[model samples]
Structures are given as C-alpha cells and as structure tokens.
Target: MDANHLINTLFPQGAEIDFDGEFFTGTGQVGDKIVAVLGTQGGVYIGVELAHRMAGIVLDTVRNHPGRPILLLVDTKGQRPSRRDELLGINGYMAHLAKCLDLARRQGHRTIGLVWSQAVSGGFLASSLLADECYALPDAEVRVMNLPAMSRVTKIPLERLEALSLDNPVFAPGVENYRRMGAIRDFWQGDLAACLATALDSPTGPDRRRAHGLEREGRLMAYKVAERVRHDPV
Candidate 1:
C-alpha cells in the first residue's frame, strides 16, 4: 500500500506531515490531542540516517507535547543490509532510537505501536516493539523472516521448517502467529483511526506478554524461564 494512502486513512484531518521514503512524521487530528504519528514504509531499511530521523521525532514530541500520545506505525524490511551500515555502527543507532521512545514512555506520554504494514527485524525492534502497547492490522506481516530464511539460518530444510511452523507458531510468519507468541497485543479489526484512538486512550500494562503467550499455549517456556531468572538471577 502507498504510504500516503495509508496515512490519509489513518489521519483524515491530517494537515501537516512529511515522508521521505525512510520515515513519516506529522501531526494528525486523530483523537483529541494533536497526535504525532511516526512510522516507516515501503520496506524501509533502518540505517543511521533513518534511525536518527525517527529518534529525533520521538525526542521532539516528548519534549514538546507534554501529555500527548505518540503513534508508531512500522512497516520495514529491516535494518539496512549493507557492509557500510555495519561499519558505521548501525547497532548503536538502533539503540539510540529505542532509547528515545523509551524516554517518551518515561515522561508520561502514552505510546502505541500499530503494525499497519510489515514490522520486520531491527526496524520493528528499535521502534514499535518498544511501545507501551502494540498491535497489528489483520493483514500485516509481523515476523523476523520467512520460513525459508529461518531454514537457511538454522541449517534446517525448508520443508522441515514449514512443518514445524504449522504446530509451533513461534516460527510462523503472520500477525496471528506473532500475537500468539505475545509479540503483538491484538489484531486491529476496526478502522485505523478508531483503533489508534482506543489504544491511545488505554493505559500501559505490565509486561504480561510472555504470560499471555503461555496461557494461550503458543509459547510454553518463555514466561517460566523469565520468572526463574527474576527470582534467582545468574
């Protein structure tokens, strides 16, 4: 989907915004406050430039908005897959963006991440994955990579990975699978504006994601392991 069309659907009263193929930052009258929505689209690869732009937006909002919630829309391929980016310390840039979002949450501004499109790899991690509340569109793709890539990475055959994904959703590649694994909060079955408003109005919850996954039987061991570590740290 074109980013402009997606933005229009999200912010019908949007009058000020900007998108330059890396990230989108703008003010839209979605709810009561002047909600600032920032996101990536068109398989954006998060490099140093893109990372700094996104981080700057979050930091600026936190400093200026005072009590407004910031909406995160992520649709990316991943961090730029280039030797130059790796050489320039892309990991540090990613961490910087994550820190800026974390600062927003700390400053009493509600943070909501909606995977309106694909939320892949480091692009998701450094942005929406850090949201106080995160969700996904029903048609959105939310995963690290597809089964074939997982197969290659793990040295397993694609057929074996495909078979495993059928039963073990942690290895699957859809919003449903990600929700079951406690990665995404829920599927946005409503219109984009309504969904954004609802999430913005909601309070941030404890990190019960692993618990949600365990109860749903999608992920069986993550919660227990984390609990044990909390009780007896190594």
Candidate 2:
C-alpha cells in the first residue's frame, strides 16, 4: 500500500507524518500510545547514509521518549551496491543501526515492523527482522537472495532449489512463508489503529516463534536444535 493509504488506515485522526517523495519520518499515536514511525518507499536501495539516518531516528526517540513504541515500515530493494561503501565500512554503519534498534528494545520501547512491499537482503536485515514483533501485509514480498542468485552462490541447480523451495516454506518468497518460518509472527488486517494499539499493549518479548514454526511444520528442526543446545549444557 502507498503511504497515504497506509496513514489513512492507521491514523484516521491524522498522524503527524511528513512524506518526501523519497522516504517518510515522523511520530503518531497508535491507540493511546504515541509511536515513532520510520518508513521507506519506491524500493530504494538503502546506503550507509540512510542506515545511519534510521539509527538516528531511533536513538532520538529512545532518548526523548522512553517506553514508546517504534513502528518500522520496510520497503527496500536491498543494500545499495557501492564499492566505496564497502571500503568505508557500510557493514559497520548497518551494524550501528541494528545496535540502535536493539538499544530501543533494551530501554523497554516496543518495536514493530510492518512490511507491505519489498523486504530484501541487508535492508530488511538491518531493520524489519530486528523488531520485537514483525508482521506483513498479504501483498508484501519478503525474501533474501532469489533462487537464481542462491543457485549462483551455492553452485546448485536453480531447478533443484526451485523445486525444494516449493515444499519448504523457509526457501520460498512470500509473506506467509516468512510467517511460517517464524520470522513474521502474524498477519495484519482489521482496524489499523486498533490493531497497532493491541500490538503495542501485547508486546511478546521472548516469544514462542521458534516453537510456533515447528508446530506449523515449516521450520521443523530449529526448535528441536535449540532445545537440544539448551539441554546439553557445556
């Protein structure tokens, strides 16, 4: 969904969100709780500058308003392919951004991620997947490297991986498949404001996603492996 439609759905009373043609940043109320809103559009490839800006946004919100919810709207194609960025340690900048969001979580600010469009590669990893509670719209496209790229990297036949991905939710590319893999916890619908409000109130810290994935038969071995690790102490 476009930002305007999304804003209308979520903030009927008009959220104080400012949208440039490129990206959006602002704060608004979800139910009775005020939240920090950060989003991107047009499938922009996020670079180091954008990543650091996102970090700043979270850091400012956490410093000024502790315990407030932070909402992330992830719509990025991937990381910007720049040789200079690699030289300048873009990886470190992304890590810093992740640290900022983690700091928000540590400070008791609930973080939520909503994906209605592209959620791919380093862009998604630096933000959306880091949320305390993650969800996706039905139309959201969520995936890592596409099958062809995976084949190229692993030197496996694309046809083989494609067939496997059809049966294995973890290998597939869809919102429901991510939910199945326990990455995205739920699907979102109904009243947007009320839904966000409920999400804020019901912060599932240390949730049962790994177990849910196994129960749903999507990520079969993850929970068992974790349990095994837990039981067999060093």
Candidate 3:
C-alpha cells in the first residue's frame, strides 16, 4: 500500500508527518493519544544515512515524547548491500538505531512495529524485529533471505531448501509463516486504527516469540530447549 494512504487509514484523525519518498518522520494521532512515527517506504535499502536518521528520531522521541507510544512502519528490501555502506560500517549504524528503540522501550514508551509492505534481512532486524510487538498487514512480505539465497549461503541444494520450506515455517517467507514462527505477533486486518490502539494498550513483556513458535507448531523444540538452558545449572 502507498505510505500516505496507509497513514490516513491508520490515523484517520490526522497525522503530522513528512515523507520524502524514502524516509518518514513525524507524529500521528491515535484517539486521545499521540504516537511518534518513523519508517521507510518504496522498498528503500537501509543504508547508513537512513539508519542514522531513524536512530535520531528514536532518541528524540525518548527525550521529548515522555511516555508516548512509537509506531514504526517498515518497508525495506534490506540493508544496503554495497561496498560504500560496508566501508562506512552500516552494521554499527543499524545497531545504534536498534539501541535507540530499546532505550525508548526501557523509558516506558510503547514501541510497535507494523510491516505494511516488504521487510527483509537487516532492515527488518533493526526496525520491526526490535519493536516490543511486531505486527504485519495481511499482504506484507517478511523474510530474512529467500530460499535460493539461503541455499547459496548454507550450501544446501535449492531443491532441498524449497522442499523443506513447504513444511517449515522458518525457511519460508510470508506473514503466515512468520506468525507461525512467532516473529509477528498478529496481522493487522479489519480496522487498522483500532489495531494500533490495541497494540498501544497491550502490556509489554519479555520476548515470547519462541513460546509462540512452539505453540503454533512452526518450531517444535525452540521453547523447550530455551527453557532447559535457562534452568540449567552451571
């Protein structure tokens, strides 16, 4: 969906935002409350510039917004896979952005990530995956890497990975696969405004993706293994 249209649907009451075809920053109204909005669009690659800009927004929100909620609208292909970005330490910039969002959460600002479009690789990791609760639109595409790419990286045959993805949520891409893996809390359908509101009102908790993965049968042993590790005696 177009970013402007999505903003309107989410904040029917109106939002004070700025989008320059790639990055956006501003405040959005949600009933009696206001949320700090930061995001990317047009399937932009998350380069150092974009990562730094987003980190600044998060830090500013933490310092100025007090306890207001934050809404992250994600739509990125991934981090910029370029020699220029690599030379400039793009990973460090992405980490800074992630840290800023974590700071906001620790300071009592509710952080919610909504993947309105595509979210992949490091872009998703530094944004939506860092949120307290990450949700996605029904049509959103979320993935770390496609099967072919995974095959190249892991040296597994493309055919084998494709076959595994048929029954393994972790190896596939899509909102349903991610939901089954518990990376996505839920889908934002029906009423988007109400969905945002509910997310803001939702209580924050420790990461529950592993437990959700187990319950949904996407990853059967992750939760149990984590529990055993947590309780293991050194």
Top-TM-score structure, candidate number: 3
Candidates in order: C-alpha RMSD to true structure: 1.8, 1.7, 1.4
Q: What are the runs in model 2 whose C-alpha is more than 4 Å off?
A: none
Candidate achieving the largest lDDT: 3
lDDT of 2 at 58: 95
Worst-scoring 10-residue span by lDDT in model 3: 165-174
TM-score of each: 0.93, 0.93, 0.95
Candidate 1, run of 10 with poorest lDDT: 13-22
Better by lDDT, candidate 3 or 2? 3
lDDT per model, in order? 0.83, 0.85, 0.91
As a whole number from 0 to 100, the lDDT of residue 186 in candidate 3 is: 93
| Clashing residue pairs for model 1 | none
What global local distance difference test value does model 2 have? 0.85
Q: Candidate 2, residues 1-234: lDDT per residue as tens digits?
A: 787788778877668888876588898866566788999998888898889888999999998999888999868988888998898899999899899999999899899999878899899989988889788887888988788888999999999998888777877678888888788878888777777777788846686778888877788998999999989978
Which scores higher on lDDT, 1 or 2? 2
| TM-score of candidate 1 on Cα atoms, chains taken together | 0.93
Q: After superposition, how far is residue 42 of candidate 2 from its true place, in Å?
A: 1.0
lDDT of 3 by residue, 111-213 (tens): 9999999999899999989999999999999888887888899999999988887877877787899999888999999889999999888889999999998
